[model samples]
Target: MIQKQNPENERIKRKFFAYLQGPLGRDEKTIQKHADAIAWFEKTTGHKSFKKFHIDQATKFRTQLQTATNARTGKPLTASTMDGQVRMLKTYFVWLSQQHGYKSRISHTDAEYFNLSRAERRIAHTPKRKQVASLQQCKRAFDLMPSATLIQRRDKALFACFMLTGIRDGAAASLPLSCVDLDEALIYQDARLMQTKAAKTITSYFLPVDPAYEVCFIEWVSYLQNELLFGHDDPVFPKPEIAVGENGFQVAGLSRDFYSNASKIREVVKSAFTSAGFAAFAPHSLRSTLTRWADKHYSSREAFKAFSQNLGHESVVTTVGSYCPVDEERQGELIRGE
Candidate 1:
């Protein structure tokens, strides 16, 4: 049976969403996740009114969340997943405890019931092994990518660009040709012009990867400028233009416009890696690869700091703490003084 939503809950949810977007400065995707978390709590309570919110309800929700299964994997939700969802709910309820009608009913301390056990919290915070490509693996993938047509050339260039510069997928998707400097080997990820994380303006220098990757990227840029007559304002990686052909709608050539999002860029990266007989590595994994590379090559602290800054990280600690997780094999080797 379909459970009916409380009108009061819906009204307050809209207000909370606005608070998230306006006051909290959350993006649409993040706001949606917050909404989903709230909805999950509502579902647990049979769409009960916020005015009726109690400590027991939160306890019940947390207990159910512990055993919840992921719809996609058909496996029990991971500690991390449950942790995130619970945290979101806990935050929401804490906020609710201060709101007008909810203040008297929901105590601030009541939200503590949503927390996981100490052991579960520790497990949730543990970082999992990330899938990062080797520099050689990236080179092999780049070499194997066919560059027969303009689309193929673009695909190959895009793959090379990711390796040559550890730019995020969103930034790369919206990057303008003018932002790229072939002579300087730099990328100006200007937030005013392109999509950057947290609207940060980053100055990224191309990493010293394979020279072949740089050559491929340079040739692609030259082709766009000289042969295609593409202007500086055009997208660095434009979507393919679709036109009606004998077989129906088909890709004609490069479009002058930027992609609406980074979905296509991720697809290209995944295809390139998989086709080259490697596990499908997302564009973000390339950042990890670069981080690992920096760990090995940059002997001096100053050089490593500069390298971290080039990757758009404010602090070297942020880069190391987030990206430089040693695999178990490497950890074992290090322990043995190998």
Candidate 2:
């Protein structure tokens, strides 16, 4: 059910969304997090205005989040999840107090109550190893892919691009033909032209993976340019078109536009991994896979630099904190002998 409509809150949401898109320039992931937090707060308070926010409300939500269980996992929510949701609200309200018509009702200091305890934030922010797929696992999945249909070709191309470039799913979805220079084995992730993290621009040199992996991407690019007669300025992965056929509803062929969302890419990845006999892994997991690969091949600075550029991160430290955790098997091997 919709909360009782509050004009002020509704206006604030709109303003906040625009602010997020404009000044904040946050990634979709960050924007969505803020939206979820604001939605939860609106639901709790019946769409109460920011002017009515109080310390008690903030403290109570913290307690509620602690007791909350994840709907799918059926376990207590992770501290990271709770921390992000609460922090988004805290930051929003702090900004709200500085806005016109709300200075008296809200205070910048009031936002501090939204923070989790220092112990809780530590638990939330601690680095943990991710169980990313290994190079061997990726090769298995690729070998198992059946390239018999156009959809299949696209699926194979999707995985090939990701496995090689390690670009985020959204950036991959939004990539243009011109962005890809198969001749140079590079992707020009120009931030002015692409929706990259922090809107940072960089050229991603496709790392040397399997020879077959290189062929898969090169062939796909050629197919799009030659067989499909697409120019150098089209979407690398256009959305699928739907049509009514003799057999009723079906996806017929390419839609004339790129995907505005990354859902299709994620779906293709899940299907490919499942068909290859592995449990499902999200498209984002491939980043950790690249990180794992980098750690083995390069020393600390080199590894960090490669991982940072791959993820469009400007700082090596941020890349390490955000994405470079080694799996347990690697940990054991390193510890066992040395």
Candidate 3:
């Protein structure tokens, strides 16, 4: 249900968003997340104006958030999620305390109440090893994806594209046919059009996976050009065409344009993995697989630096810091080997 909008709260939120965009230089997605955090806090406070904020309200909300359950899952939110919510609220309060109308009413020290206890902060920040499918497993899933219809063929090809290039899903969705260089086995993710993180344009070559994976990707290119009559400027992975059917609106075929977002690419990956009798992995996990593979294959710093660059990382540290969590099995292997 839509919460009743408070004009006072809404007006203040507009200024907050403006502050994030202008001085802070936060992106739209980041600003939106902060907006959501503010909305959640407002909801808890019965849409109370910021000018009315007090230390008691901050303390109460912090306690209430600990017991709060996810509306969708009906389970308590994870510490990391709770941590983000609290951080967002704290940042807002700090900012609120400095604002004109709120300054005298709200004290900067009151924002400290939003901080998670030390133990909770430790739990929230600890690195957890994320699951990444091996190259062999990804190839199996790609093969298992049926190509009975145009949509199936497109989905199978989409999975192949991810495996072959390790391009982020959004970049994959935004790829023009021209960006795919079949002769070079390279995908040029031009940030000029594609939604690359940090708007970094990258040239990623196909990984040293099985020949079959490359064949699948190559066949997809042929299918798009020859079968679908897609041109140089056409989207490499087009969105599904939706139309009214006998039952209701159903996907008919591949549309002639790119997906507005990467959600469909993610859905295709999840469904493909499930059908192949594997736990679903997000599309981004493919990058981790590639990273781990590089960790094993590359010994020289230059080689690894090149590997990082291929994944669009400006610095090797950024790549390793984010995706280099060794799983228990890998950790055991490393320990035993040495």
Candidate 4:
């Protein structure tokens, strides 16, 4: 049976979305996640009115969620996903309880019930070790890939670009030709034009790697400028071309426009790694590699602070806490040296 929309719930959601967008200044992605969380709650409750919510309803929903299985995996939902659902719901109810009409019915204190137990919260918050490719591995991946055709060259260059600069994949996909200075070896991540995290305009210098990696980047840029006659306003990394084939539309060559999103770049990363006989690493993992590299190269607090800023971190602590987890091998070396 299809669940019908609840008009009252819809109205409340609209108001809530407005509140999040305007007063909270949330980006669209955050707003959409909140909206999705609310939609799940509404579906579970048979599309009930928000005004009719009670503490028992919250408790029952929490119980239901604990038993819920992921549609794709057929396993119980992960603790972190459960935690996100509860957090969003709790925030929503807390806001609702303060509203004029809801104040009479819903108590703000009741919102606390939409929380995971202490143990579960700990599991959700714990950081897991991520896979990061070393500079040598990145070079191997780039060198191993075929670069005879236009698309192959683009894919190889794309991998090299990520390894060279450690720019976020989103920023890389949307980067304009003007943002890169081949002579200076600088990338001007202009947030106004590129899709940077939190719209941050970052000035990132090329990390010291094998000179061969820099050559890959420089040659790719030169191809776009001298051979292709691409102007500075064109995308630094353009999209793949589409052409009709016997079966259907097929990727033929390179498009002359920027990719609207980072999905293609992610695919390129996955394929490049798979071809080079390594476990796949996401583009963001390269940032961790760069951070760890910086940790080794810079011992002075002031120098580390500059390194943090180059990665667009407002505080050095943010870089250390989030990305500087020492591997067990490195930890052992430090202990042995001491």
Candidate 5:
């Protein structure tokens, strides 16, 4: 039962999260970001009724948040961070205006004040350079990984999978052995089972990074099948288990479904990169690295289709718009090389 919430705003937030999860089709990460902003605002206002919300409350909160220093950076929060909080708040209130109990109290127009000014919005929304691991850096990191245990082998294979396929981490977590066809030399990224981005699905074949990694991919599939006894229906990257060690506390070891989440994959990635003396890169960065590689390796129509297919993107133009941004240093390198 949804308990009587807040005699104030508690009921509203739960509903908002539901809408975000359901109709919005938002990923958990996005819902969490929006939920966090609302929670902070509610806590700041001492659980005040949403019916009493006003522009003044928004202004005061914005001011307070502006002077606050980032816990990680130790500098006053900039327009960007403040802007994100404000933006989420605005959207929530706009959503609030349409809800059953709130239609009269909140106006769609009132939420407009929660917005950053035009110039501030520009600063807040500006795209920054995304860091990705280059293919060479990835290879060095993969080579450094010690495949001592089943978990270790899986971690190494996880790195190779990212470099080879450019699949998103969550989708990677949900990949099933049946979707892979080593004999056919392709992996079917079918969204019906996998948690593909925006639910887009496509088949991705191996890139030209290294022919040798092909054997590693085959071995990984074989290990899942013959040794682990995983069936075609099982996750490609199975989750490691947590059980009591000799000391009687929980210890994690290779046990079985790709992580219920992506944290384990992230942890293994950082460890491998640090071991290889390469900069730590998130799994998504592999996409950017592949895009850059395609820019140099292929030309015209072929490059477009190659990168588009690599990303599961529906259009080559969309791929270029999203990933083909040429930074100044990289631009200089390209001009100099040619």
Candidate 6:
């Protein structure tokens, strides 16, 4: 039997979401995650009222979540996934406990029941190694891509741009031609003009990956300006114009508009790598690739710090802690005092 959503619970949830957005300054994606976590708790408790939330309810919800299987995967949810959901619920209840109607019924102490065990928390926080493409591998992929047609040229350039700039795919997709300066080899990720993580205005200089990448990007920009007459405000990598023909909808050429999002840009990257007989590495992994490259090439601490800054990180620690990982071979060599 389907359970109906409680109107009172729905009203409070909406209020909480607004608080998260207005006071907490959370983005849409984060607010959605919070909503999902709250929905999960409500579903487990048969849409119980937030005003009636109790420690016992939270305890029951945790137990049920632990045993729950993902509908899509048919496998038990990972410790990290469960941990995140519980953490969100804990935060929500903590906030709820202070609200006018929920104050007497819910207490801050009650929210502790939503926390996962310490063992599960450890698993959730542990950092796993990510797959990052090497400079050589990226170059090989670029070489393998055919750039005879306009669409092909854009694809090749977009792939090269990721390696050259180490820009996040989201920022890259929304960049206008004016944001990139070929002479300076820099990208201005203006938050007001484009979508950036945390709405940060980041100035990212091109990393010293390979000159070929810079050359490819520069040529593409020149073509956009000279041949296509694309203005400074035009997207660096425009979405392809699709129109109906005898063969039905097909790509005609380039449009002077940004991609709706980074998904299509990621698709171009994945196809390039797979075509070159390499595993499909997302464009974001290029940041890690640049980090690894800097670790090898930059000998001085100052030089490395500057490189980290070029990647739009305010601190070198953020760059190394997040992107730098010791491969098995390197880890073994260090352990052996080699």
lDDT of each: 0.89, 0.82, 0.85, 0.85, 0.80, 0.89
- Clashes counted in candidate 3 amount to 0
155: Cα error in model 1, Å:
0.7
Off by over 4 Å in 6: 1-3
Regions of candidate 1 where Cα sits further than 4 Å from its true position: 1-3
Position 225, candidate 6: lDDT: 93
TM-score of each: 0.94, 0.84, 0.88, 0.93, 0.83, 0.95
Alpha carbon RMSD to native, model 2: 3.2
* Model 5 misplaced stretches (Cα beyond 4 Å): 1-5, 69-78, 99-104, 241-254, 331-338
Candidate No. with top lDDT? 1
- All candidates: CA RMSD (Å): 1.8, 3.2, 2.9, 2.1, 3.9, 1.5
- Which predicted model would earn the best TM-score? 6
TM-score (C-alpha, index-matched) for candidate 4 = 0.93
Superior by lDDT: candidate 3 or candidate 6? 6
Tens-place lDDT per residue, model 5, 1-338, is 33333655766788888998899888888888998888777766666789888888887777678677988989988778889899899989999999887898889998988877789789878878777777788888888899887778888888878777778887888888888988877789889988888788878887777765666777988888888788888887887677878988553755555667777777787888988987778777778887878877778897669668868987887777677787779789999995
Q: In candidate 3, what are the lDDT values of residues 104-199, reduced to their tens digit?
A: 988888889888889999999998868888877787888899988888877887888877777998898898998989989898888887888867
Q: Residue pairs in steric clash, candidate 5?
A: 239-256, 239-257
Q: Encode model 1's per-residue lDDT on 138-174: one tens digit a residue.
A: 8888889998898999989898888888899999999
The true-versus-predicted C-alpha distance at residue 5 of model 5, in Å, is 6.2
lDDT of 2 by residue, 21-140 (tens): 888777777878898898887777777777888898888889899999999999999999999898899888888888888888888899999899999999999867565677888888
Give every collision pair in model 6: none
Off by over 4 Å in 3: 1-6, 242-253, 336-338
- Compute the lDDT of residue 59 as modeled in candidate 6: 87
Candidate 3 minimal-lDDT segment of 10 residues:
207-216
lDDT of 5 at 315: 81
